[model samples]
Target: MIKARDALTKIKPYVPGKPIEEVKRELGLDDVIKLASNENPYGPSKKALEIIDSYLTNLNLYPDGRAFELKTALSNYYQVQEEEIIVGNGSDEVIKLLSEAYLNPGDNIVQADVTFSEYEFGALLMGAKVKKVPLKDFTHDLEAFYNYIDDNTKLIYICNPNNPTGTMVTEVELIEFLEKIPKGVLVVLDEAYAEYVADTSYPNSLGLINKYPLVVLRTFSKIYGLAGLRVGFGIAQKEIIANLEKAREPFNVNLLGQVAAVRALDDKEHLEYSFRENAKARESFYQECQKRDIKYVKSHTNFVLMQVEDADTIFNKMLKKGVIVRSGSVFGLNRFIRVTLGSIEQMQRFWQVFDEIGG
Candidate 1:
């Protein structure tokens, strides 16, 4: 038998929601609506499909290692220097690269206890410790996060509009937290669902890059509707980007992803369309929760976390009904369930099944 690193001892496998095809196959259902992963219900933009179709004939050739064209497009879009960006297979890879670059056996990362699991997974991969801060009022407690920092801390993660809960910290609180952090600690503002946020008070993470040693990560997977293509990028100072680039694999993002992402960035109409529709659907979900007198966390992301009785049972029941949602046990909150807000017809079907089953 081979010996693995001690770090593997502390890690648990990351569980994703059941896929639509698998559910359909197992349950023998023709129509399966998945609100489990916060994916865009409308699917990819037409422009991205056109771009991908053009690139399909060139599959035999290796992708451009530098990703020069996509990087240039992102530079122009975000008003940042080309050298200030690092694109990855997904934002998940960049997080792993950061951990590889900075974390050591004793170094630690600080994040909310119930936020994104990737932070802990990345840290543990490099044998780094994790200090988990409890969320106050179902949102990131900035004060508590500040207090958790110490000399051994190497990275800090704030998943704005955090996963599972979908709640966020305001702009003022974020600025204050960034201002007081000790030098040398890298802060990652994970805004995976930033496009769904309708709140004007959400922090402008890009504007703070010049002032702090941090990275702003955004994904094409959410509102951009390109999750299957697997493209996400990070914005930071040139120096931070340089360090991360050293650890990035060549052609980490495929040819199709680069083309699709560039095309997606240019399609503002598609972006806004998904945004407006998601906002409308999310509100309807909120109203349904209200009408049913169910307690739910106000969400800036596309998912809502609702406290329920026997979440695992309700989760299985929803799955059996061909409407798949996430059970809160995946996030350490066994009495709650997280449901993604989807299209009006999808949401209506979900609620119809849920109404019958009684969550």
Candidate 2:
């Protein structure tokens, strides 16, 4: 066998949430509710769907390599120059591009130990060392990230309203941390669930990009309900975006994704409605957990990480009942499970199944 890179050994395969179809097929059941991936339960805007339908005729042609129209729409929406944004197949690809553009063998990147796994994957793929700082109070310990950084550190990942835990650092805290970052190191803020957050303290990240060596990652996958489209993007200073652009594959984003994302952006009513509904569902989840005497981390994102007796057993039980949720074992939180906030009906189904299994 041909030898693979030594770094490949350090990586673990990512386990995504079970697909609804796959679960139904395997369990021989008709109904399955997926509250696993932190996807928008309320799907994409009708306008987006219409645009996608209209664009079907363009399938034979190639997508705009630079995604000019989509970038223009994003620029207008975010009040940023088009040159500052880099669209990707997904935010995951942009993460890879950042690693390709900056990481080198012997260098290191800093991140929270229990945060998103992709950061570690990207660093390892480029043969860079991953320096993990433990989360403080189920949130990114931004101050601790400073200690992990040294001359060799090239990137720092802060997953705001972090995955799995669903906690976040306040704007005041993040600004203080950003101020202390060294000149050479770049900070990547993965705000994939930013649209779901109702906290007034959330950082207005786009404003900071001009003053700091920072990149803000956003995704249509979550709030815009375009997960199937796989459209995500990064906003940074022109220099950083230029470097990342060099590493970006041509037409990394598909034609349908670009059009859908553009329409999704324009549909402010749909965006507002999704946000409102998510807030309501998240609060209801908290109330339900409290009623059952279940301990849960306060979530700013669309998911809640709740403590369970045995996550693996509960997960399997829930799966058998046609309720799919993420077991916390993947993130090394063996006693917890992360569930997305679904619609009222879906939430009712989840609770019915959960109660039946003694969750």
Candidate 3:
């Protein structure tokens, strides 16, 4: 076999949630509800769907390499200059781009131990060291993150309303943390689930971009329901964006994705409805967990991490019953399972299956 880069030895492949079709095929089930991935069950806006057909004829040509139209839309919406934004295949790609542009061997990145895995993956891929700070109260310990940074630290990833645990750092807390970060170190605020947060204290990360060496990542996947389209973007100071752009793949966002994302941004009704419904479903899940005396971390995102007697067993039981939830073992939280809050009807089905499994 050809010799691979030594960095591959340090990296573990990301295991995504089982798809609904894959579950049905493997288990011989007719129906399955997937709450494993934190995807918008409601799907994309009608306006976005309407524009897809019109873009079909142009598939023979490559998409605009810069994703000009979508960037313009985002610029108008966020009130940032077009030069300050970088569109990617997904925010996931933007993470990789940042790593490629900055990380070098012996350099290090700091992030919450149990937060999003991509931050670590990116660093490891570049042969950079990862310094993990344990979460305090299931939330990012900003103070501890500051302590982890030294001259070798090149990046810091803060997942607002962090993945798996769904916990958040307040605006005041984040601002304080940013103020303490050393100059030349880039702070990446991954806010993929920002639209789902009902908390008034969630930081306006976009507003802080100009003041700090910050990149705020947002996606059309969750709130705009364009996960399948694979459209995500990052907003930052033009200099930072220019550097990341150098490492980005040309035409990373597909043509249809660009058109759909632009139209999705215009669908205010769909955006509002999705946000309102997610809040309701999240609250309902919280009540259900409380009534059963199930321990759960309070969430700001559209998912909840609940403690169970045996998460692996519970996950398998739920899987067999046509419900797919993410076992927290992957994040090193062996006793918990992270479940995405679905629509009212889908969540009802989740509860029905969960109860049948004696969970």
TM-score for all models, in order of appearance: 0.98, 0.99, 0.99
Q: Write the per-residue lDDT of candidate 2 for residues 1-359, one digit (tens) a residue.
A: 99999989988888889999999889999999999998988888999999999999999999999899999999999999999999998999999999999999999999997998899999999999999999888989887888889999999999998998999888899889989898999999999999888889999999999998999999999999999999999999999999999998897999999999999999999999999999999889999999999999999989999999989999999999999999999899999999999999999999999999999
lDDT, model 1, position 42: 90
The superposed Cα distance between candidate 2 and the true structure at residue 176, in angstroms, equals: 0.8
For each candidate, the alpha-carbon lDDT, in order, equals: 0.92, 0.94, 0.93
Worst 10 residues of 2 by lDDT: 139-148
Q: Give a tens-digit lDDT track for model 1, residues 1-359.
A: 79999999999998998999999999998889899889999989999999999999999988888989999999999999999999999899888998998999999999998999999999999999999999988999989987899999999999998997999988899999988999989999999999998899999888899988989999999999999999999999999999999999998999999999999999999999999998898788989999998889989988999878888999999999899999999988998999998899999998898899987
lDDT of 2 at 265: 95
Root-mean-square deviation (CA) per prediction: 0.9, 0.8, 0.8
208: Cα error in model 2, Å: 0.6
Model 2's alpha-carbon lDDT is 0.94
